[model samples]
Target: MTTERREPDRNADERTMLEGWLDYHRCTLARKCEGLTDEQVRTASVEPSVLSLMGLVRHMAEVERAWFRRVLVDDDAGWIYCSEADPDGEFRLTDADTWQEAQATWQAEIDIARRNAAGFALGDLSRGRSGSGGEPFSLRWIYTHMIEEYARHNGHADLIRERLDGATGD
Candidate 1:
C-alpha cells in the first residue's frame, strides 16, 4: 500500500505538532519499503551491515513497544524480535523474516503506542526508568526522542532506497 504522509502543521499545538511529525516519519519509513520485493526489502545497505528496510521496521517496532508500552504504561511488554542476550536481534534477520510480517508488527506497535500515549498528557512521567537505571521519561521526552530516532533511521532508509533502486523523496 502507498503511504500517505502529511506535513506537520506549523500552527498546531505542541502535542499535535509532535504527533504529526512522528506520524510523518513513520509513514516515510513505510514509503521507503513500498514496491520492493521481499529480497530487496531484506537487502542490506552494505556488506557487513545488517541494516535493511525490513530490519528498520522490526527495530522501530521494538522501539515503539519499549517507549510506549513498557515505559509509558508499565505493561511489561518484552521485546518482540530482540532479547537481552541479543540486543540487536531485530537487525539480524533470519530466513524467516519477511516484509509483510515486519510491516504488520511495526504497525501494530504504532497502534499500541497511540493508545498508550492517548491516556496521558505530554508532560506525564513514564512509569518506568530508562535503560534500567536512567531517569524516568516524560511523554514529551519520549515523543521528542521517537521523532529523532525515526529521523535518523529514515535518513538511513533514504540512502538505502536510493542505493537499491534510485528512489528518493522527503
Candidate 2:
C-alpha cells in the first residue's frame, strides 16, 4: 500500500483543508482492500447483505466515478458501474468472480477520481449542480457530501474487514 504525505499549501484556504481530509479518507478506504486473498475479499460475515470487502471496493469505485467524473465534471457521460435495470447492482456479485478483477476495477476507478480531482481548484465552487432536488448545490456542498459518504462507508468497511480476517489498518 502507498501513502501520500499531507502538505499544507500556504495559498490554500479552509476548503482545501477539508478536501485533503476527504482525499485521505478515500485513500484509506481503498487501502482497506489491500493484501487480502480472493476468498477473504469476498467473504461476508453478515447474511443477505453481501457487503464483502470486495463489494465495498466496487461500490466506492462507482461512487468516485459517479460523483467526480459524472456529476461534478460531465453530466452527459454515461453512468459508470450503474444501471437503471438494477439500481444497486454495483454491489451485486458478478464476473468480478476473481480477486484480481475486483482489485483492478477498484484501482481503475480510484485512479480516475484522483485524476479528476487534481484538475479542480479548491475555491471553484461557483457552479450549482442540481441532482434530484428542487434547487442546485454548490461545489462545496458536493465535496462535503462525498467526504461524508466515504467516511461513513469506511467505518462500515473497517468492521467488515476485521470480521472477515484479522487484518486491520495499513
Task: Pull out the clashing pairs in model 1.
Answer: none
Compared with the true structure, all predictions reach lDDT values of 0.92, 0.70
lDDT tens digits by residue: candidate 1, 26-54: 99999999999999999999998989989
Worst 10 residues of 2 by lDDT: 121-130
Judged by whole-model lDDT over C-alpha atoms, candidate 1 comes out at: 0.92
What tens digits encode model 2's per-residue C-alpha lDDT throughout 39-122?
777877588787787777777777767776666666455554568997776567765466677668767876776676666665
Stretches off by above 4 angstroms in model 1 are 131-134
Question: Candidates' TM-scores?
Answer: 0.96, 0.78
Largest TM-score belongs to which candidate?
1
Candidate 2's TM-score reads 0.78
